[model samples]
Target chain A: MQPTSFENMFKDAFENFEAEVNPQIWVQVQQQIPTTAVTPQASVTFSGVKTLLIAGVTAIAAITAAVVYKSEPKLNTLVESKDNPVDNKVEKTVAPVQSIEKVLPELIKENETQKVQPAPAPASTTVLKLPETTNESSANNDNQASEPLNTVTNQTKIKESEPVVEVINQDDKHENNLSSIQNTEAEKTKETEEIKDFNWGRISNTFTPNADGKNDVFKIHLPDANYFKATILNINGKILHEWEGENGFWDGKDAGGYDLPKGMYVYYIIATDTNGNTHKTKGSISILK
Target chain B: MDEQQLVTNCLKGDKTAQKQFYEMFARKMMGVCLRYSNDLATAEDYLQESFIKVFGKLSQYQFKGSLEGWVKRIVVNVVLDELRKNRILFDSNAEVTDVLQTTDDVVSNMEAKQLLQIIQRLPTGYRTVFNLYAIEGYQHNEIANMLQISESTSKSQYQKAKIQIQKTLKAQTII
Candidate 1:
């Protein structure tokens, strides 16, 4: 039989089959259809949702207001001190050290002398001045004590040299100040080196290797002697390709059946050393069509 | 009222047309809901939710295609949204790995109802693809786009569903 003839015959049979089924039962099935109520309780629930949304918004606004109120004073102080040149100069020199000290109490406490030495040591050394009264008192005392004297006479000379001893104590205080300054400079240098190391670890280098004469594939130069697992993900955060093998390279095609679209994609690299230390780096790459 | 007049009157919020419209589409859409839902009660709830959403968003519907198709799409979307909210349909731990290879000899002899029953018994990932691709007449690309999966994943899931259905049918006969 032809396809249309067969289809027409099937339709007739199906209608006859439907007619054989009870029309009352079908009507009863239709009558049993479920109804949803938008009652007063549902309205109350909706109002509650509205209240919650309003409360959430109010909370966000209050938090924002609190942050702004907290930061306003510091901002005003900065703006007010912007005009006074001498005061500004002094503040510029001293404020950073004070702020640094305030921010990092442990660092300040750990290297107290280092904090003092870096800024003031050179200035103090250049402006060195000795008190003259103590020098004159010492000379006079030495002249008075001619020969080997009795204990009482020696005591008398020492008493006369009191001013000289005070001068010596003042000199010793200056020397201590210099030592503290040297300590602070050393600590600062050590901290700077640490910061440099941290920055070095964070540095990410990318090279494109598109098989064009120009940079084709994106090459990541991990810091010397760091092993990493590199993963390339599409815009939807789906991992298109992953490389866990010793050689950290991804040709950009997924393990599935198709090539990825040419667009901006994110790559994540997680490096772990034998020492159980881990570092993560993420960046984007562009694929040319 | 006829379907078109019912739709137009329902769009105007006429209670009679609204009731008639619900009566007309509820059963077929309930079947759609039942296929996606975990149970009959949940299916009924989904159907209610879908109708409410359809009524609310009726103004956005452009009359470019069959109204039935548009309504069916809305119902399917509501089911998907419910699945997402319940967290059972797309559990993160459910990973689709290698496709299962099964002999077609068993699948060829299976009836449509038997095939559908087996499809229903498959995992959520496989069942969704089987329903969308095989029954709903969606392409792999469209399924991928709608489900937010790769096209390859959609194909693989359909293949896995077929293999699973074949195996289940074979096992049932043995029993």
Candidate 2:
């Protein structure tokens, strides 16, 4: 039987019609298809390692933040002096060492100059409370202080030769036993170099946008920049928001000023330093109530 | 390459052949997925999910029909499965609207995107049935079995969907 004119019109339009599909769909599909094209075993192992690395980085960051929170007065000076150039490096180095020592005591011993007294190790309860206190500040305030610590942790992980693999294994071990394995002084210098190069903007992983004035907006903490441009994208890789200049921020809303649901969003930033060097960084941000 | 060779290479875990196979059908399948979904994001989700299923179940395909037809069915089923999870299609009360006069010339003049937008604005029940019966060429009884709805309901949903589309087209002064 012949189709009606109405049915024929739609079929004619859509039968051979091709709609534009997002390229990100192919990426997600590739990640999921285990048995075909990509080796299932290899993808599984790689993702497993990635998850472990993220967990290890997060644990180190938490421990470091907790320790820094414990040594409140000294770090308080460091946090306040974040406005000054003199104390920025000290604050960055000390925070990371405390956290790294919790996971790798031997590594911290190499940088004993920046080490805080490890006697008052923070309890698990203290570790859980640290993020809350930090979250109380504005997005630029707390993230400016805490975000680099995670970057340092990640950079340190990359510098060590597969030690993250061993770190995971020795996670439950006491700190004293971790100090047995000595890391070369050369590696410490390399880590310092990596940290020095990452002076560009850093963003927080999560922010609360319930309009409490504290962290109501996701801000990129760029100390000095002639040019800055950032684009925020939803999971589908669609651009939701875009901003330029150093003071630009996203208040958990789309370009239309609609509140986006709380979920992980991706941000791509390109900042041109006063020296004409460009810095590019991309990471995920999560919106919370 | 021919279909048999491509399928064989894909089954043997050839990355190039798998990508070629995907590039070959991704557009057409995305069209099918878009018609069944409300937005590009949801359509993309169904498209990716269905392709994953297609690749996984490629071994089960007996080369009994056209590979495109086989893949399209999988894409449609994935969308229906997702809509079923919402469970709003059958449970929501059907709203009544006047059946406005529609001209085939008006719909034909509309760009494919405009037509797609009109289809997307349809209520879930009417949209699903309209896609299955009008676009996918499924009979009402077959759609009833697929959606687990009464055949009469499928017919009425399609009719209501047609009226809704015509109403929207009329409102746009396209007719």
Candidate 3:
């Protein structure tokens, strides 16, 4: 046969032909060859992962702090006062330190020189209660009757840190108990006083809401009215504002918007002392704008 | 399944697809190995080695051309590789027969099975060159490169294989 005929026949016969393949051949192939499953490469760097974790942690901490600030906003009230002019006015008008009991402390300081005791122990927070007197009738009352106040300093620490503090407003029943224990429990401690006499202390006769760091509030001086509910009503008896405490005072506002107009507003105080004694007294505060 | 899918499945280490892949090409690849090998056992060894290499290098095979063609090339390389390792052909340096110029009558005269038997009977040198140039259609230069021989040597071995096949056919009285 010619070489050309031979090559053609060879290609035709065997190109697609299959011989018997041993089944065991595949087993040998499988044993020798590794599986081609996916192999992971080292892709992510360590610092990249660390940055992600740090970012996540910072986000969580910020969210938690925001939640805390929102829930207990009063905790930031001190800090916010400096930034907010409106809040500055509000604070001057209603800084808790201006207790209705503390009269013009500068005048009290001046009076103390003449009234100093021979003990020379200095002016103190010790006193029988001052008589209750509102700013309207304050002209009739002796504004300088009491000695200078020596606040058992930081007494407000007992509850809210106000210079004038009524930690827990009690009735007259607790008054005797309070006086007997006053030296032992009331000092380095905040406690109540008597409800026997309905008296007024040095009342600030004018509430100048000028935010001038002066008398921007009406200090209603119902000193014996522990456990009291008091409302400031208009001349029409329209209740403008209401406040209560063992001894509480009010901001010159209606508790919401602008300050009350410069005029007389009623201060109606109904006091229930620890002794269950209830006293109702109506007075007025003149807002001198 | 298409050749590309079959290769992909095999690459994924799916044992069933691997088995199926073997099933699809095993017989044909064995035919190629058998021509290059001395016996059924040796041919089976080459078949296994070829398949292992086929799976190992599957990822390197870009699926642009025929997948079967790619696999067939791997099987052929495995045969040549085994021959080179044993080195029986180079050791013998057997004489080249004067059968290069003969007609194709002898190879054509035999049955396909008989032709395969006679081809396997040729010496390793002649047999591999014949399988590459004749059945596999590789040029003499390619065969020379594959067998690590000169182009003349590849031609000589192929001619000698033809003479051996012709003699076997004459004895069997096929031509």
Candidate 4:
């Protein structure tokens, strides 16, 4: 007989071995096995995915709606009414007169102008012209009128002589009022323009006091010469040391006069300008000892 | 099924595949747990807990390295949790200078089991380092992370464990 093939013999022997050994171990494994079924968490995961999809769809729909809404034309009737010719003409004619009337007392209170030429022109013209109207008797009244006319001519000559003084005072007052308004508006614009330029750039907080000359001191070089206070904090958020003055220098020492260990620290700087406006910057520093 | 297919099926929540995976790795993981645990029952408990954790966190496994390594890490973490619960104290000295001198005669005479027994008799610190470095082929830096000790301390503890085991074996032979 031919010798049994190693593969067949091995397979038979392995099957017998498994048959003999598997039952006991399997039984023990079953007995120790937890009674609870390992419930599939797929439903929970699917619900989570469903919620996320719904949220994403809602967000996308909201954004699309907002975009479409903004792109659509929306005309305001109130704005259109203000631009209409009838309204514009009425406002243009009335606003200046009302504004002038409102500002007159304030201008007078400020003593910015002198009340001279034409101060009571309309009232005096009406008062003085009444007698000329009532003297309707013909040539018989003319001689009497001529005598009054000579007195009127004398009064006109007196008024003509005072007109130059009145005109000079009125011109000076008008120029002063114009300059005061222009100066106030110019000052306001300058303040707004200055505020736009007040941004401080990147600042370095890391400082090494190892005397190696790499990063020796924590320096906050302000963009401008301003009063500043800097405080150093440890990892526990305790204010370890603080320096308040013009100098932006902080030595790497705690409040208790001890060198802090090598680790991360925080530095906060509060800078105040001459106008009393304050800006704050905070950052972290890594110290290597 | 091939190992990858089995792993894929396990990830798909195929209970049969998961059971096969548990059977394949549980014994070896139990051995790992036994080394870290105080006794057999605690070792068994840690083994079961580690398997549950391993299954729960299976999604995080990126298949970058050996699956066995991932399972072993879970087992070790489970054992460490038990150790932590027992409030085992760890020395925090940064500078550890302890050195153990081991003779060639001690190594030639002592079996691995004898050495293991002596190590198990050691304090938690020395045994952890010895098992991680000597038996598990871990570098001191890796051992440092596992035990939260400085690298130098890990090296020193391993050397101290070797010396203590050698002395014990030497004493046994003389007796």
Best by lDDT: 2
User: Where is model 3 more than 4 Å wrong at Cα?
Assistant: A1-3, A39-289, B91-106
Model 2 preserves the real interface contacts to a fraction of 0.68
* Candidate 4, A43-62: lDDT as tens digits: 55334334544466433333
lDDT of each: 0.50, 0.66, 0.57, 0.52
- Model 3 docking category: acceptable
Query: Which runs in model 2 stand beyond 4 Å of their true positions?
Result: A1-3, A36-289, B91-98
Query: How high is each candidate's TM-score?
Result: 0.37, 0.46, 0.44, 0.38
- Per-prediction interface RMSD in Å: 15.1, 8.3, 31.9, 20.2
lDDT of each residue in B1-175, candidate 4, tens digit only: 8767777777776768778987777666665665564334345556656776677677678877888878888777777775665455555454445434444455544444444455545666666766666656678898788777788777777666666665666677678
Separate clash counts for every candidate = 12, 0, 25, 0
Clashes of 2: 0
DockQ of 2: 0.32
Winner by TM-score between candidate 4 and candidate 2: 2
- Per-residue C-alpha lDDT of model 1 across residues A29-147, encoded as one tens digit per residue: 23333222336575564444335444664333332333233222222222222233323332332333453345455643544333323333222222222123223322332344233
TM-score of chain A of each: 0.29, 0.32, 0.30, 0.32
Off by over 4 Å in 4: A1-42, A45-289, B92-113
Please give the C-alpha DockQ score of model 1. Answer: 0.03
lDDT string for model 3 (A47-137, tens) is 3323433466433333233222221222222222222332333233234434421634553343233233222221221111111221211
CA shift of A204, model 3, Å: 99
